[model samples]
Target chain A: MSETRMPALSRRRVIVTAAQLGAASVASAFLARHAAATPESAKEWLGKLAKGEAKAGKVSIKAPEIAENGNNVPVTVAVESPMTAADYVKAVHVVADGNPNPGVASFFLTPACGKAEVQTRIRMATTQNIVAVAEMGDGSLWTATRQVKVTIGGCGG
Target chain B: MAADVKPRIKAPATAKKGETFEIKTLVTHEMESGQRKDADGKTIPRKIINAFHCKLNGREVFSAKIEPAVAANPYLSFFVRAEESGTYEFTWVDDDGSLYKAEHKIAVS
Candidate 1:
């Protein structure tokens, strides 16, 4: 009986993998032409901003755990930086994983800003993860993510 | 383009030298996301403020690249260090090449 169960589980896993591959192909095709945003597209955007892979640290995103309305959800991103000419945050890019368009906003900073923090409101199409990546003056990248449960969709009229 | 478009700013009128202070700004615009359909089921064209920046005197302090995922009547808050007394000029650039600006004066003691 144990041997039979093992074989069945392995067969199920193969089928699941095949299905995932099929879905991924379809997603990629849609991602190229459609204006809607997906996890893959969001990752691509982050990659462009970071100019490399971003490590998860030194950045924090402040957002509500639950949002009753997806129309306007407040989000704040803060990075740990000295804000000095020698060491400062260059920019912070934000993306919403479940929006029609994931490109939320990008804040460009200078040493005169005196802080590596910015706050803005965003529109969420559904419950999704908000990711922020901060680029440092030394070309290093840091990232953080937060999930918000959006009760209502925001893209529709 | 939307009507009644206006930019409002919130900044300290005075601050100590080398002090870091927060600046908040908001602009009135529909920010049509181009994802919505009209009664005839036609998609509305996207129109939004695409960029914003703040300059202290003649130097750049902060700027932002706005996107469609931003909410309507976009609001942003950032920080600035008061090195010396100067006028802060805030500018918002719209999709149709319209520029909206506002100014605030800060005194550093």
Candidate 2:
């Protein structure tokens, strides 16, 4: 009985090693492909903005701790400013870190708003951080972010 | 307005000078998440309204960035203090860089 158990244990070990190697190869290939594509896409989107690029700060993003429905999630962004013509929030950009298209939305504001807050609802593909970047009239950037746990997959990614 | 555009906004038609009021807005859009598949199994391209901005008397007071995770027909409500009698402008920008603007004038006495 002991001799028979030895053979079975050895066979299991071999199988496990084979599976681990196969998984590692697959992961490496995926990483290589993603590495080749990500930077180009990021550059394309960032270049389209007026400032050519945005730094993180100046904007605040609000989202729930947990979302029951991934299809519809509520999000809000507020920027601190005087709302005066001389110095006001020029625009705000929302980006979803794990979403297929990271560049989410851009809002352009003027001095007539009298406040610096906006609220809306959006869809999240998975659990990830939502980032908000605000561009002010003085050509400076500010940012705020929130991490939301999405229970059900909405984007189907 | 584009044939594909649906815009909706709600704010006080009138308010007193130096008073605060709430404004609400919603736009009808598909807000494709780019991760979904149609019945045919093709990936849906991500398209969403990326930003919303509001102006009072041609001055901006509030703005936000939108994302694909935002639910369809995005709803936004916020407050603004009316400084003088003038028009409040609301603009929603889409991912394609199109702008949808609406205006409401307030009378201050």
Residue lDDT tens for model 2, A8-109: 458789999899999999998554322222434534554565464566665677789999787788888889898788998877666666555666667677
Interface RMSD of each: 0.8, 3.0
Please state the CAPRI-style docking class of candidate 1. Answer: medium
Candidate lDDT values, in order: 0.90, 0.72
Candidate topping TM-score = 1
For model 1, state the Cα shift of residue A47 in Å: 1.4
lDDT of 2 by residue, B1-109 (tens): 2566777778878888767677888888777656567889787887877777777676667776665657778888776777778887888887778888888888877
Q: What interface-residue Cα RMSD does candidate 2 give after superposition?
A: 3.0
Question: What's the DockQ of model 1?
Answer: 0.69
Candidate 2's TM-score reads 0.69
DockQ of each: 0.69, 0.45
Clashing pairs in 1: none
True contacts kept of each: 0.93, 0.74
lDDT of 1 by residue, B1-109 (tens): 5469988999899999989999999999888898888999799999989999899888888999999889999999999888999899999999999899999999999
